[model samples]
Target: MGRHKALPYVHRTFRGWHVRRTWVNTGEVSQLNRARIVSAAIDLIEREGADAVSMRRIAADLGVGVMSLYNHVPNKAALLDGVAEAVLSEIEFTDDPSAHWTDRVRAQARSFRQIAHHYPRSTMVVVSRQLQSSSGVIPVEYALSTMLSAGFDGREAVQLLRVFIAYIVGSLLREVGVTPTFAPVRPDVDVAAIDGGLFPVVASLAGELVKCDHDEEFEFGLEMLVQAMIVRRGARASTSEPPESGVIPSPGLS
Candidate 1:
């Protein structure tokens, strides 16, 4: 059928799910099943990432029939929520909100990096999952609670959380080649063939170039982001005056 005919039914189905989400007051039993499937999903994702997880495979791995899964999960999209949560919870972060915001943020960012290290494919899921599920929101709250306690308003907290997490996770994704730890290079051709009259700087700097570790490099960027955020927070606090009454702020001018 054309989209014009399909659209109404699609909208109604989604509207129906919003009501199904409230089934049984809360998803207590479903949450417990999520705990199981998510555990298996993490292993599958580590081997193949977010795409590797399917209700069929997860149910098989858990030794439960596929129909049994529906009692706990709505569909693959909902199961993805569980997988993302399991990946997030793998990071061993302390939950005490009394810690300084920087310290807590450091821990939060580090934990996410650690999770991404193990489940590289789920990196996409970490920052992108919807908050309708409690599992998906817990780790986010872990980070936001620190910012909230640090006197950041809601809007600022969300902006910084996205910025910081994306910067850190994006940096980690760039280091994918080395994370699972590959073996040394085995060139198919003579190594000296490509060395004809090389750029002197690169030739002379071979030792330093070979010694560089991207994991260490990724951490450095995360450190710089944290420092820059701290500086921005301080600068905002030190502003001499607030905007004048009735003045509308222009975008991208600051």
Candidate 2:
């Protein structure tokens, strides 16, 4: 009689567990599909341009209908977020932490330059989408942690990120001279006619343009910034410290 009375409670507990399991399975499936969609979109955009990325294009690549993607993602804009996340996942960091801060920052800068070379359209995706996605924040968070461990505040860390990113991106853009927008290279146009007569100096020094390799410039810039920051920290310590404790930061080639 007691067993029968408690049967309802047992059934409810099992039912609740079943519901949770079902929801977990559904979530897993959704994530898998979203990853596939993002990978397909990245491939398409790399082969084509941002202007060429359409719902139909992505759907065709995914072997699913355009409406089917909406089940996982609300719209194309949301899908682009996934694509940017997918593109950023390719970045890998070295395991050696003993390297100088300059080396670490320069490594990250060089990675960006290489990504720009391999995936030219990725910059557009990164620029267009917000960094609200987890993939976008991973590298940024790594940068901040590295900076903080090296003794930097939030504002200073962010400023250095901005400066480092801008230098690498701008340098790559100049090096590649990609004719994506406003600058047009017609299919049938001659390569050296227009600039030869009008901008001789630009043409003359065109050969002097820096290579796509960013190791040298990145190291130099990172070295300067890190040194300046260390000096600033040292100056602050000297001004406000007990002369008895001479634990000032040793300024090295970081």
Best by TM-score: 1
> Residues 63-126, candidate 2, lDDT per residue (tens digit)?
6788887887787888788767655655555423575554566566666666666666766687
| Backbone collision tally, model 2 | 0
Model 1 spans with C-alpha error above 4 angstroms: 1-34, 60-64, 95-98, 148-153, 178-206, 239-254
What are the per-residue Cα lDDT tens digits for candidate 1 across 141-207?
7778877766567898899888987777666665665233221232332333335376666556555
> Candidate 2: deviation at residue 47, Å?
2.3
Name the lDDT of candidate 1. 0.61
Residue 113's lDDT within candidate 1 is 80
User: Model-by-model lDDT, in order?
Assistant: 0.61, 0.58
Pairs of colliding residues, candidate 2? none
TM-score of candidate 2 versus the correct structure, residues matched by position = 0.61
